[model samples]
Target: MKKLLIILIACVLGSNIGFGQSKTKLKEVIVRPGGQKVVLGTKREKADYGHGGAPNNPKYQTAYFIPAKGASGLIDRVGIYIFQKHSFLEFLKPSNPVYLYLYKADAKDLPGELLVPEPLVIKPKKNTHWYWVDISEYSIALPNDGLFAAVSWPKATKEDNGPYVGMTNECDSCPFYLYHFPSEPRWLKVDERMKKSVEKGNKEKLNQNLMVRLEVSLKK
Candidate 1:
């Protein structure tokens, strides 16, 4: 009877261990690159933007630009791209986050007439940073003064050490690509309120050839 009891106990332990292993394997599958999808926020929300460098490309040279919709003369163009990974967030994540940088072009920097182009629309996911670009803070009502190209990364704060490249399950195992778009609610500048806001903190006024750089690092 004692031998039979021991055999039963051993079987129970073996089953529990097997179950734990199975659960662990399942989690691994779920976390594997591209296990989930990253969704963008509604049209009413602002999209994030970022820049960093990638190792795969040589010359260490890279360029990424998202055209503005109604920029015309006010904003010639908005641009951002990775100079280098700069951090681990460059990889190892469920979704790519946004990186924002600002550049104010000086009078001498202005070249010629700016052409307006259609902007790309993207959605944002919770706890995920997505790249975003805007031609004007508000274009529907006040389009002239509101002109200025800007790129921003949503979610990832300055505390993050490196820039991370987000991954989604939809195109699992494929290179990540980000979409661009304008800011919603159509920002309108009233009595230099927008200008003052841009001058505050590190934000500067609009320039003829503005350029911004951003990097993102993932947390744990």
Candidate 2:
């Protein structure tokens, strides 16, 4: 498991370092909100596969379709299970920043209208485990169908950098999307990307369910 994890994050995040040993369980992360908080995602260890930037797309994005799963009316937090790909003196260097975004799920289960008015900056760490962010201020509402929690890279990101989000094979499946900067539609399903790869005769396929998740209140 350890050896495999090392390889997985390295390839996905475009780094060359060990991801660290996997813990048995993800502890319930606490937030400032008074009501109950629900952590949603694969609920299992991160899968071997991962997702990130694409060629020619300097500022790309990837999102996970998260179901309300009985969440409260308003969202308060967003969490991501991430693993660091650099831990040496090089780790002393700051991680490239990314943006956090939320969108109501569309009819086709894609990200619809942007939820947050302004994109929040996320300075990820060099570690392994869940990193939770306070979005209680956003007061994002849970759509009836579901929502999409996404992260986007900077234009400086040519292909990709370290500190990547994870995926999981636990639930049999989960819906996720990727966005090529400045595209007309702006979002594409992971399977759609895979199909294009095959058409181009590339052996690669993007079967990923990002670990991105959001928390909502249990109270009215």
Candidate 3:
């Protein structure tokens, strides 16, 4: 009887291990050699934006303008860095859902209409790292000029609870847009804020960019 129990235990352990291995393998399918993988966005991580990068009402959707890696390509996936608070109570909190959207860059280099039929709501399973979503099935056209990879982070349920997007230390050349609402709900360039800061004689620049990126496959 003891020998039989030992075999059962081994079977249980093996099954558990196989379950985890299969899950990881599924997530890693994008690492194949078929697509020309190009990480398009700031890979740097210095700090978190707006209370741990929590999505709020003012900036409903933060869209980063990523230049195309090739003359013609298609996006395999998009990713963003996320972090949580350092408090002891952080573990007790559950983060809010985030939305991932795509937009075309307008003639003025601004975010144009929505590319996807609807936003992809992302619920991150981990913290303090980059989280990516597979959208290759959409076959979104990636132009040479680039596309806007927007993260629509919802507001945190509690103060400590978060699904925050991190920020890079430098984004001087990176162009991003924000959604201004209530009075007018439209995508606006963040350049106006910098212009105001300059007008006020503030020598220091914002120099911050969202930690958002994309993996695109080059074509033609």
Which number leads on TM-score? Answer: 2
* TM-score, model 3 to reference: 0.70
What lDDT would each prediction earn against the true structure?
0.25, 0.59, 0.56
Instruction: Please identify model 3 stretches exceeding 4 Å from their true place.
Output: 1-31, 45-59, 86-93, 157-161, 192-205
Comparison by lDDT, 1 against 2, better one: 2
For candidate 2, lDDT tens digit of each residue in 1-220? 4344323322433421223335436544445545565666556665444433443444567777777666557777777766555558656777777677888877777888889887777777656676778877867777766778777656324434534556554443343566653424357564543434332543433345666666666564
lDDT by residue for model 1 (7-78), tens: 332222122110000000001011225232111111112112223222221111111222223222222123
| lDDT assessment of candidate 1 | 0.25
Of the two candidates 1 and 3, the one with more favorable lDDT, higher being better, is 3
Estimate TM-scores for all models: 0.22, 0.72, 0.70
Model 1 stretches astray by more than 4 angstroms: 1-78, 86-90, 94-96, 99-146, 158-220
Q: Model 3: per-residue lDDT, tens digit, 1-220?
A: 4344333322221221100000111121234566555567664544424223322342456677777644466777787766543345655555577677888978777778778888888766564556778888999878767788777655543343346556554556554565644345666564634434432444434433666777777663
User: Model 1, poorest ten-residue lDDT window?
Assistant: 17-26
Model 2 earns a TM-score of 0.72
Of 1 and 3, the candidate ranking higher by TM-score = 3
